[model samples]
Target: MARFVLVSDTTLSRNYRSVPLLDFLASAPTDALPNAIYSFLKGPPPPAAEGRAALAPYAVRKLEASLLKHYSKDEVVVAHEDHISEFIDEDTEVIGVSTMDPLGLGPLTMSYAVFFETRAHAYVQREFESLLARINKARSGKKAKLLVGGPGVWELTVRPEELDRNKIDFAFQGEADDIAGDLFRYVSDDSGEKTEFFRGYQTFNANFRKEWEPNPKFISRYQFSKQFPALEEIPDIVNPSVKGMVEVMRGCGIGCDFCEVTLRPLRYYSPERVRREIEVNVRSGQSNAWLHTDEVFAYQHGRHYVPNEEALLDLLRAVMSTPGITRTNPTHGRISIPAAYPDLMKKMSSIMGAGRNNWIGLQVGIETGSDRLASTHMPNKTLPLKVGPDGSWSDIVWRGTYVMNKHYWRPAFTVQVGQAGETPEDNWDTVALINRMSNSSLDNGLPFEFTVTPMQNVPLGLLKSRDFDSVKLDQSQLAVYYASYRHLAKMAARDATSASSDTNVAARYVTGALVGVGGWVMFQQVKSICRKGGLDLEKAARHGLSERPQVPSIAVIR
Candidate 1:
C-alpha cells in the first residue's frame, strides 16, 4: 500500500481538540483503496472543546462527507514532531504540508499590547522554513514528492524565488483535500512519465470538491468549534440559548471592494433545512441559537429568499409552540440576526416581541451614512435610507433601543468602519454618520452601546488587482478622521455628563470640540510628511495602525 503523510503548520495541540485534523485524516477511506495514511499534528493542540458545539449542523455535515470520501480511515495515523520521523519510512510516497498564514487583519484580541506583541506574519515564515527542514530530512533516500498547501502559500507577499530556493515540488491553493488522490495516482504509476502525468492532475477542482462536501456534521465540528473552542468558558451573558446556534447560509453576494467574503460564490442553506437543524440542536439539549451567515437576509432557495417574512414568522411560531418551551424563555436565549434586509429586521422584531425586553438583537452593517461614499465602496450593503419611501433611512438606534426596552431590557449594536477602498470623501462621510448616530441616540433617549471597530483592509487573491489602490494614511486625512472620531467621542461624553448635571455641560462640550480640533492639526502634520514620502493613503493607514514592536523580536511560539 502507498504511504502518505500530512503535516500542518498550525500548532495542532493548541487548535485542533474537538475535531482534530488527525480525525479527518484518520477517517479518510485510503485503506478501502490502495493507500496507507499517517498524519502528524505539529505544535500544541487547542486548549479545550468548550465552544465548538455552537456551529450550525449544516456546516458540520459537509466536513464529514469530504473526509470519508478521500483517504482510507484505518490507514491513517497521527503524531507530533517528536514522532514525525518514526512515521516517515522508506515506503512513504508523498509528504503533504498544510500551512496556514494570518492575513494581517489586526490582532485577534482588541488589546493594543497583544496586537503589537504578536508577529503573525513572522510566525508564518518560520513555520514554512521549519516544514521545509523536516521535508529535507525525511528525503534521505526516498523519492517522495513534497507538497504544500494552505492559506500561507497563497499570499501575494510570498515570492517565487523563495519557493524555488526551497525546491517545493507543488503547491495547492485554497483546498488540499483532493491532492492525496492525485498524488496516489502519480506515485503508483510505473511509467517514468510520472511528472508529466501529475502536472495535469486536477488539484484545484479536486480540492474544491473535498472542501465543499455537504456534510453538516463536519462543518459544525470543525470551523465553529475552532472559532470558539471553549464553549463552557464563555460567560453566561453570551452563552447559547435554548434553540442553540444555527447557520442559515454561507457566502455573500455583495462584492464590497474592501471585503473578502465576496471572493467566493454565495451559497445559502434552505429554510426547511435550517428548521431541521434547529430541531436537531434543541433535541440535543442546546438552548440558544445564533444564526451564522455573512448576509442572513440574502438566503435564497431556487427562485425566492427562504423564510421571507411569512415563512420566518411561521418558523418562530413553530419554535414557540414546541411543548414546554416558551417564546420568552427559549432554550436559545437570544438570536443574533443580521440587518441586511430591512423587511427581515421588521419581521424578526415583530415576532420576537419587538420594542420590548426581547432576547434577540439585530446586527446592521451601517458602514457609512454618506450615500455616495457607501455606494462607491460597499455597494453590496443596501443603505437603510436608500430603501424606504422617499429615501428615508431606518432609525436603527431608536428601533434597537425600542426593541431592547420592550423585550430583554438591554441595547446592543455593532458599527464597522475602515473598509479597504475608503477614500477621503468616504472617511468624511463616516465621520458625519457617527456624529449623527451619536446625537440621535441622545435625542431619542436611547441607551445603546456602540462598538466602533476600525479595520484596515489587507490585499488578498483577486482583491489584489491594481484597480483599487491601497489606502495610505496621510497627515491630512488622518487628522480629519481622528478629529471627527474624537469630536463624536467628546459629544458622547458631554451627553453623558449633561444627563447627570447641567453645570459642566458648556465646559465639557467646549473642551471636547477643542480636543477634536487639536487632533485635526496633528493629523495635518502627519499628512504632510506622508505626501513627501510618496505614500498611498491606504498603505499609510496600514503602517500607522499596524502594531510595530519596539524590539522587533520574533513572536514566542509555544
Candidate 2:
C-alpha cells in the first residue's frame, strides 16, 4: 500500500483555505494510502471565532469523497498534525501538500513583527517561499514524489511559466472533484508517467467548472455559542446577517471593465429555496440573517425580481411573522435605490426598519459629483439629480436633503475621484459637487460623512485600448491634485469646528460662509499654480480650481 501525507500550507479552516481534502480522501482508492497523515500550520483562530473549531473533519470529508470514488473507505488512514509525530514510519511513497493558504496569504502572519510591519504583498511572497522550502526539505532523499495543489496552486501553476524556479513533479490545478482518480493513477504507477499526468492537468488551464456536493463528515473547528453564535454554525457564509447567511445567487452578469465577478454566468436561487433557508436558520434561533449575493438588489428568483417593492415587503412580513425573529440584513453588496425610483426606496425603508436606530442603511455609490466624469469612467453607475429647466443649485440640494430625511436616517454615500480617463474638467466638477453636498448636509442637519477616496486607475481588460498618454496627469496636474486634497481636508476641518460652536443663528451662518469662502480662495490658489506650471486649464478646473489667480476684489461664492 502506498503511504501519502497531506500538509496544509496555512492554518486549516473553511473560509480562508479552500483545499477540499476530505472530499478527495473519501473518493480515493483505499490502496492509495495504507497509512496517511495530515498536518496544518495551525495558526491562531479567526479574531472573532476564538480558534476552537477543528478543520480536520472538513478536510477529511473532501479527501474521503475522492478516495471512495476509487478505493475502499478502509484503505485510507486519517491522522492530524499532533498524531503524526507518533506515526512517522517508512514506506511513505507520495507526499501531497495543500499550498492554498501560503500562496494566497490568507490573513495569517509568521512573526509578530512581520505581521505588524510588512505590507500584505511582501508577506504573501515570503510565506509562499518559506512553505515551498519546507515542502522541499521534508521530501528530501525520500522515494515519495512531491505533489502540490490547492486554490493558489491552481492560479500559479495553470501556466508552467508561472511555477517556482524549483521543479514541482505534479500540480493539481483545478476543482479536485474528478481529478483525484487521475492523481491515484499517477501515484500508484511505478513507470514515471509524470508527463502524461500533467498533460491531463492542462485541461483546467483552458476551461473549468466549480461543482459542490455535501460532505457528511464535514466538521467545523469551533463550537459556536448559543447566545452570540458564529456565522459558520449557520449554513453558508454568503449573505450572512445576525440571523444567518443565505445564498441569493452565485455569480454576476454585468461585464464592468474593472470587475472579475462578471466572468461567470449569473445563477440565482429560487424564492422557495430562499424562504426555506431563511425558515431553517430562524427556527435555529437566529434573528438577524444576511442574504448573500454579489448584488442583493439584483436577485432574481425564478422569473421575478426578489424583494422588489411588493415581493420584498412580502418577504419582510413573512420573516417578521416567524416566531421570535427580530431583524434581517444583507451581508453583501451595496444597496442602491435609484434616484428615479424614490417610491421603491421609500417602500424598502418601510419594510427593512429604516429610520432612527434601524439595522438597515442604504449604501449608494455616488462615485463623483460630476455626471460627465462618472459617465465617462464608471458607466455602470451614473445617476444624477433630475432638474427642471429652471431649477437652481438650491433646488437640487433641497430635493436631495428632503429625500434623505424622508426615506432613511442613515444613508451612506461614496464618491470616487482621480479615476483613469478622468480629465481636468471632470475633477473640477467632482470638487464643486462635493462642496455643494457638504453645504447642504450642514444646512439641513443631516448625518452624513463625505469619504474622498482617490484611486489611480490601472488599465486592465477593455481599458487597454484607451490612450494613456492623453489621459495621464502631467507633473503640474499631479501637484494640483495633491494641493486640492489638502485644501479639502482644511475645509472639512473648518466646517466641523464651526458646527461645534454654540453661537446665534446669524453668527453660525456667517462663520460657515467664511469657511466656504476660504475654501474657494484655496481652490483658486491651486488653479493659479497649475496655470503657472503650464498644466491643462480644463483638468485644473475638474480639480475644483479656477484659472484666475486669487484676487482681493473677487468675492467667494456663499
Candidate 3:
C-alpha cells in the first residue's frame, strides 16, 4: 500500500466547466445554491486513472512532488477523491488533504452568510465534511494518520475544536516544500522532539502583527523565514494540475496592513522554472496557463515596488513560448501598475495575445475607493503613484481600468466594507467608484468590461466564535452590496454566453443561460435585503454617474 496518499478537498478537484471564476460558486451557501446547479457549474470530476487522480489541485501536486523526493513513486499516490478508498490499505501510514476555506469562514463565504442571513454551510465546508467522513470511514481499520494542510488550515487554527470534531490528527500551518519529507516522517513515526515544528499556529493580532499560541493539534514553521523554502528548494510538479495552474512567485510585498501575504518573505520563480511547470500542464492538454501569484506586478520588482517592465515581459514571453500555451494571465495584481504604466500594459497584453476574442482576466483587490482608507490600510498598493499627486485612489483605479479595457483586459475587482475605522462616507465612496466605472465607456465606445464583488471585513473573533448569524450589514454596507451586485448582473447578462470555454456547444449555451438567469435572481435577492436594511437603491444606482469626469484615455496619456 502507498505510504503517502495526497488529495485535495472535493471543491478544488473539479474543472468548473473551464469557465473563469466559476470556482467562486463553492463559496455560496449549499442551501442557497441547489446541489444541481452547483454540480453543473463544477462540471464532472477529473477522470480517475488507475485509482489515481487524473489532475489534482496545484498545492496537492506540490506536496506530492515534495514527498516523491524522499519516497518511491509506488509509495506515494495522488488519489482521486472518489477513489481515495482504493489507495488506503492496511500499510497506509499518512493521508494528507489540502483545502481552501474548509470551514466557510473565508471572506467571500462569510460575506454571503452575513448578507443572506443564513447559517447553512457553504458548499466548500459541506464538501470538506463529506470528504472527511469518507476518509474516516475508509481508514477505520487502518493506522493512517490524517494530516490537513493548505491555506484553509488557518481556519482550523481559529476553530481548534474542529480538529477533534473532524478526527484530524494534525493541521500543518505553513508552506511545507522544504520540510515535507521530515514532516511526513514525523507524523509516521509519531514520536520525536518536535523541535523543527511549532506546536501552535501563527495568527494576527488586531493590528495585524503575527502571534503564536500553543495548541497540540496544530503545528507551524518554527522560524518562518528559515523554514520557508527557497526558490531552488521548491520542486516542479510531477503530475498535471487542475486549471493549468502554476505559481510564478510565493509572496506579495505590497504590505497591505490587513493582509497576511505581506508578512511572508518574497521568493520569485525563475522564468525557466515557470516554463517547466507550464510544460507539465501542456502535456495534460491544458492550453491556458493560469499563473498564480499574490501580485503579478511585484514579480522582480524594482525599488519602491515599481514593476520591472522588462522582467514582466520576459516572463510572459516564456509562458507564450511554451509549446501548448494558447492564453495566459496572472491570478492577482494591483491596479496602480496599469494606471502608472500604460505602455507596459500594452506590451504585456501583446505578449499574452489579448484581444476582443480573448480577454485576459485578473483579480484586483480594490478594497476601498476612499483615499483615507486606501492610504490607511494599503499604502504600498499605490506605489509608483502617490494618491494626491497622481489622483484620488478611485481615480487611479479608473485610469487603470481604462487602460486595461483598452487592451482587452477585464479585471475582477473585490471591494471590502465594514473596515476597522470605516465610516458611512467611506462606503459611499466605494459605491460612487463602482457607479462611475459601470456607467463609463471605453475609447472604442465599448462599455467598460469588469465585475465588482463586495466582501465583508469579518473579524477573526467573530469567525472563531462561529457567530456569523450575529453579523449584520448596516445601511452603508448594504449599499456597497447593492451597487456591486447591480454591476455584476449587467456583466453576467452581457458576457456569460461568450465567456464560456466548454467544448460542447450545447453545454456552453446551457451554462451561459443559467449564469444569466442566476445573476438576475441573485440581484433581486440582494435588492430585497438592501431595502430591508434601509438602503436607498435608486441613489446607489446613480451615486457617481453625474460627477464622472471625461478623462483622456490612457492611450494618449503617456
Per-residue accuracy of model 2 over 388-491 as CA lDDT, tens digit each? 33132223322443454456533334334345566665555555554444443433465333323233432222122322233344443344343444445454
Q: Which scores higher on lDDT, 1 or 3?
A: 3
**Which portions of model 2 miss their true places by more than 4 Å?**
1-44, 47-245, 275-288, 301-307, 311-327, 331-336, 358-370, 376-420, 431-439, 442-444, 450-452, 460-558
Pick the lDDT winner. Answer: 3
Across residues 1-558, which tens digit of lDDT does each residue of candidate 3 receive?
Answer: 799999999999887777776878999998899899998989888888999998999999999999999999999999999999889989999999999999998889888999998999999999999999999999997899999999998889889999999999999988899899989988888774746788888887776777888888887777554758888889999999998899999989898988888888899998999999999999989998999999999999999998898899999999999998999999999999999889999999999999989999999999998999999999999988888877889888999999999998999999998788999899999998998899889867799999998888787788878787777788888989999999989998998788688887888988998889988999999999899888889988888777655563332234
- Rank list by TM-score: 3, 1, 2
Off by over 4 Å in 3: 223-225, 547-558
Q: Clashes in candidate 3: how many? A: 0
Deviation from native of the Cα of residue 378 in model 2, angstroms: 4.8
Q: What's the C-alpha lDDT at position 48 in model 3?
A: 88
Better of 2 and 3 by lDDT: 3
- For candidate 3, which ten residues in a row score worst on lDDT? 549-558
Instruction: Give the whole-model CA lDDT for all candidates, comma-separated.
Output: 0.39, 0.41, 0.89
Clashing pairs in 3: none
